[model samples]
Target: MAGGLLRWPVVLCLLNTLIISPVRSTVWTAGSAAMTQGTAVVVGAAAVSSTDEHFVCATLDWWPPEKCDYGTCAWGLASLLNLNLSSHILLNAIKAFSPLKIRLGGSLQDKVIYETEYPQEPCRPFVKNSSEMFGFTEGCLPLSRWDQLNEFFRESGATIIFGLNALNGRVPLSDGSLGGPWDYTNAASLIRYTVNKGYRISGWELGNELSGSGVGARINADQYAEDLMNLDRVVDQTYKGYQFKPLVIGPGGFFDANWFNEFIVKAKSSLDVISHHIYNLGPGVDQNLVEKILNPSYLDGEASTFSNLRDILKSTGASTSAWVGEAGGAYNSGRHLVTNAFVFSFWYLDQLGMSSLYDTKTYCRQSLIGGNYGLLNTTTFKPNPDYYSALLWHRLMGPKVLSTKFNGTKMIRAYAHCARDSKGITLLLLNLDRNSTAQVVVDPGTAQLSAVKYHRGGVKEIKMGEEITREEYHLTAMDGNLHSQTVLLNGKILDLDAQGGIPVLESVKVDALQPINVAALSIVFAHMPSFYAPACV
Candidate 1:
């Protein structure tokens, strides 16, 4: 028995067998072995499947940023801080009172920037007359709703951006052909009500996507300028306490540079933010095509459009910051698989990184939840792949940007974040490639890792209820092919993969060389465990 205990017979053997055999079999199984002892033969075994499939690592970057709140948020004062979910409308109606600041708004304007979302949903077909529209309006929150939403924003550490109804609620089209002599009363009332309720409205957009009217109401640039200018005057005079007139936003979609330039020149000093939208997919495109569209470089194209606008704004001396108020997947519902899949993590991370370079201060995703673009799923209120991705970014990325570089031939992208917390710095890596893997470097510091966590999935289409497959998992961060073989730790290659993950040397100095990898179609975040200060890296 003593001899048997001494010779444990390699309790667990690592087998690289394809476990996708009989569908009924589980991927992991238990195994046993018999060891010959001096007195007797003892049988012992262990249950082991490949547990090293998902890989993630983090290193401390000497530079860190000020701690700030960052994460996936919704549109307008109401959504930024609160979820409107409720079994009863009246009960949920309380959401309007708690308002959050820094919301993303303007669906009507989305059309002008994207040349879409212009055609308004024909008022509920069931509404036979004004009474029904009133009933529907009662069920829904209108301009008055902003009062409560703004309160929530203030209490929750956020601000408000109210999307006005430039398309409906004012002009009655005998044939519904975009008729409005202009009703500053309701619009003016909205601005006054916000002030009366003591809610600070950071910006008040004229109309959402009025440039093309694809989904809402299409109006010429000149016409939009007129409406915006008129509304600007009323809001400015009525809310003098605001110090500045609410920011007027326009051209919500389609990258309308011509319209943006024209509006800037004609409506000088009137509009604060030149809003825009973008969607990256061709309808009915194949999976391969979708994967190609999810590339980080694609962001470069989107950024270029903003760059052109930024240059124009600088030339015109416009003071308003560029705000991506409304944007998400191609369809109202997200991409069939791409957006909902882990692939979105790469896209989102790049967005945060690029926003600073392009001088964009604020970026509002389409929805917090609801529509495919929402950060949370409407039905489950559970975080989606994007939600988890947002959570990591919010928790790690701080107020200031840090310097880091990425050199790669394939698609696994990387970004580094430094903050003044004991958790050390975090390196974010995304394996955008649906099939191939890629490796990364993680610089180690004095703090050794206390723990590690990773999120991975198969292909880009693995939907709800499906388990990620072993092949897919392994392919995500497969050693040499998908990751860099020589991961330098404090300047030396450490055999960390023997256990699988980025290594953290205990009691190491602040600047340590760390190597990490991003598995295909996965998001990897590394958290350092120890004690330190909070600052911008």
Candidate 2:
């Protein structure tokens, strides 16, 4: 829990009617919820951790590609990617943004970076820098991009695990012959520049989706293993001059249990982290599809897959973490625009909550912008439905995932976190049902609660374009278009409605009463009053 004085209005009349044998317990604000929640709350009270309790959380995995407009990449470079109306926009959104990892993809790498001309390809209007017609020909080696990348990592607290080009034209030859005339020297130079510029990159992946489809030069499992080994040696030698030997990232493709096992056995030492991708697209939003993506059983399946890989790595004396590098809702254009609808929040939230369980080091989404899979709309640079979900997780979901329960009907999904900063304990509750408001009784066991602030809205409608509130204040709406803002903090009525285009909600200073009823299909961000409050399981 973060330490900050939170002031809230005392709903005197309201509480008087609702009071029922509630003990006047004084809550003690304490430390990180990540550790404290599991240690003092669930383990101490519920006796959960003592048994088969597990901790699973999500992390970013994929590096979103930059969209180019006549050679200039747009997206978020102009300004903040909040999709709000602003006078000045940025040119390179990727510069300030820190992606979880920069994946040098295996299959898509050829299409995106090289721009090679493929025969028998679907006919479409020809466009330069388009991966559709030409692959590997579009120069991806821009020093400016790399420089911006270094700055991004430095600014946005993230590490880069760069992927080496391993597509049709980028793979290195085992023999001492440069058969493809590919200039790996350029790659070496960029790496050296990253080190010289003080970029914090420690891992390098070879390729992605190499085995599936017509990707990767079609190397067999054993041959691919040997190829990865040679590439590892070459990469080390190339960067040795600069005293930087990054851990090799490899076998980034779809989940192939047998192939991964064999490859791990053959090329264990050559890799540092095994990479894979998972997309849950099972024909529309039917029960089967939702079950495949959200059911605990599916997670169990994924866990089994990763566990087998880990065992194989252990058997081969190769111990490294796993990452879900490129993924999104259903993969192909994200099941159409419906993926951008606010309803997808539940899915995103579930993914984050479940990442730690899978032991995933990082879980990257496919595209930050562009494609239906993007969290932000590529045309207007506005946040899609998933963006708000991602932001909530990023802002509220602390390092530690605290144990919690729904109490009543399981319609509401809640995940609490002890904050690293001294901002009191934060509770993120997501009500997934679109049609019914969820009445919840929040029992932060033993911890005396003081104040709470909530951010809530309808779960379906996603507002687009710039918004100006009643007060003419300029602001942006992410996913849930907030409405009828009303806030009272510490007995002081805050004028927090529409003001200068900025939409306002309840005051952050107000204390909330217990037995709160959260609206349906809504995401409520509640912050307790106290820097380090007592443990609330």
RMSD of each: 17.8, 12.3
Q: Which runs of model 2 end up more than 4 angstroms from their true locations? A: 1-107, 111-159, 168-202, 211-218, 238-245, 282-318, 402-410, 423-427, 441-516, 525-537
Best by TM-score: 2
Q: How accurate is candidate 1 locally (lDDT)?
A: 0.43
Compared to the true structure, candidate 2 yields what TM-score?
0.60
lDDT tens readout by residue for model 2, 419-471: 43434445655554444544443454443232332111101111332121110
Report the alpha-carbon TM-score of model 1 versus the true structure.
0.58
lDDT of each: 0.43, 0.44
